[model samples]
Target: MGARLDGTVAVVTGASSGIGEATARALAGEGAHVALLARRRERLEALAGELGDGSSVHEVDVADAEAVARAIADVVARHGRLDVLVNNAGYGSMTPATGSALSEWRTMVDVNVNGVLGTTHAALDHLRRAATGERGIADVVTVSSVAGRKVSGPAVNVYAATKHAVGAFSEALRQELGTDHVRVGLVEPGLVRSELTEGQGAAQQAEAEQELGLMEPSDIADAIVYMVTRPRRTAVNEILVRPTEQAR
Candidate 1:
């Protein structure tokens, strides 16, 4: 069994599906009381029901700053404390820059970059407080992508840019919060089979699948579980996880 998170209260954004859904399940299984945040009220409610009494559902759009702040505040109020913040809400449309619609790029930046900032900013104080409490530490884990590490191709231009932006933000926050006993970490996943990658017939996608094989969302969730379960004195800074066959 994974290390217990019996008293921890976790907020998982984008919890309706994909990595967010998997992470929420993993955290709850480890004994955390999780707040599931997403725009899909029905999905969130269903997930909460599945998680039983230890979970709460909140309808939220990470792209809306004020709404996100309100949701985080609500979680803190209901739970009395926040122990883990997972910034997993994001969108990506891999269109070549030359032919891509400006709106698509804007969507990517709005959710992947600005959304992370708003959520982090709103949760920072609560996270700091959690760190000083009985847990003795708190965690902020952002689900970035391998695109954050390297620009794969022209098609991933805007998406890669947004991931890179959040990566930089996470690193800076890590440096600043290390002293506060708040661990800021990033999980860079490569080609996990999620809705984001569905329907994209990119050559890169095929190449990735053939080489490294696609990953299950649970694989990434396992990495997150590892990060948060460590002893109070240990801070897992970042994780770069990919399927064994993946070259990049």
Candidate 2:
């Protein structure tokens, strides 16, 4: 049988690893041509090879507005059309507000907040156009975090702020684009065993592995695919997914 997204095209940022990489693979499995975007050329190329045909890679830093715009344009040029954009490029520096340098906070804002804006701005025209195409729909899925839903700890100050920013933006975009048949959704994951989680201390990692069991990157990827595959009549606005043992 044919796949659900046959003949469609999808662009996934941060496709070099973690949730982004998993999302790209999942989209490709559904028969959408997947474009992997990340700063690491080697990793993207390697992933592209793993995904085989109907897959490509673009080296890009989401925080760079011009670079992101050009990358999206190139994807459209290569694929003929764009149907889905997964904004999964983000950073988290879990440092206390008092000790963390100003640059750290700013960097989080650049990648987590401004990056989303730049990609979304550049892809709006194409996404809207896709909605009117034969598929009659388009998708913009943002990989947010549990931090986006609520402020957790002092170390999550800037990261939480950036997540919150994206959450608000996704909601407003969903409101404005409903009539256009453009589905905007946010997947908020609590803890996933990725590079981001690996950055935490040994104690935290042990706790997660032993007590709560960190979620796999594919977990978040599945949530993203579900949001975009819904029938046109139903729009999944937001999904908050936490590990089974996570209380907050």
TM-score of every candidate relative to the true structure? 0.95, 0.98
Across residues 124-222, which tens digit of lDDT does each residue of candidate 2 receive?
999999999988999999999999988978899989999999999999999999899999999999989898888888888988889888899999999
Estimate the TM-score for candidate 2.
0.98
Worst 10 residues of 1 by lDDT: 196-205
Q: Candidate 2: deviation at residue 175, Å?
A: 0.6
Each prediction's number of clashing residue pairs: 2, 0
**Residue 196, candidate 2: how far off, in angstroms?**
1.0
Q: After superposition, how far is residue 70 of candidate 1 from its true place, in Å?
A: 0.7
Write down the worst ten-residue block by lDDT for model 2. Answer: 195-204
Tens-digit lDDT track for model 1 on 98-135? 87899999989999999999999999999999999987
The best candidate in terms of TM-score:
2
Note the Cα lDDT for every prediction shown: 0.92, 0.93
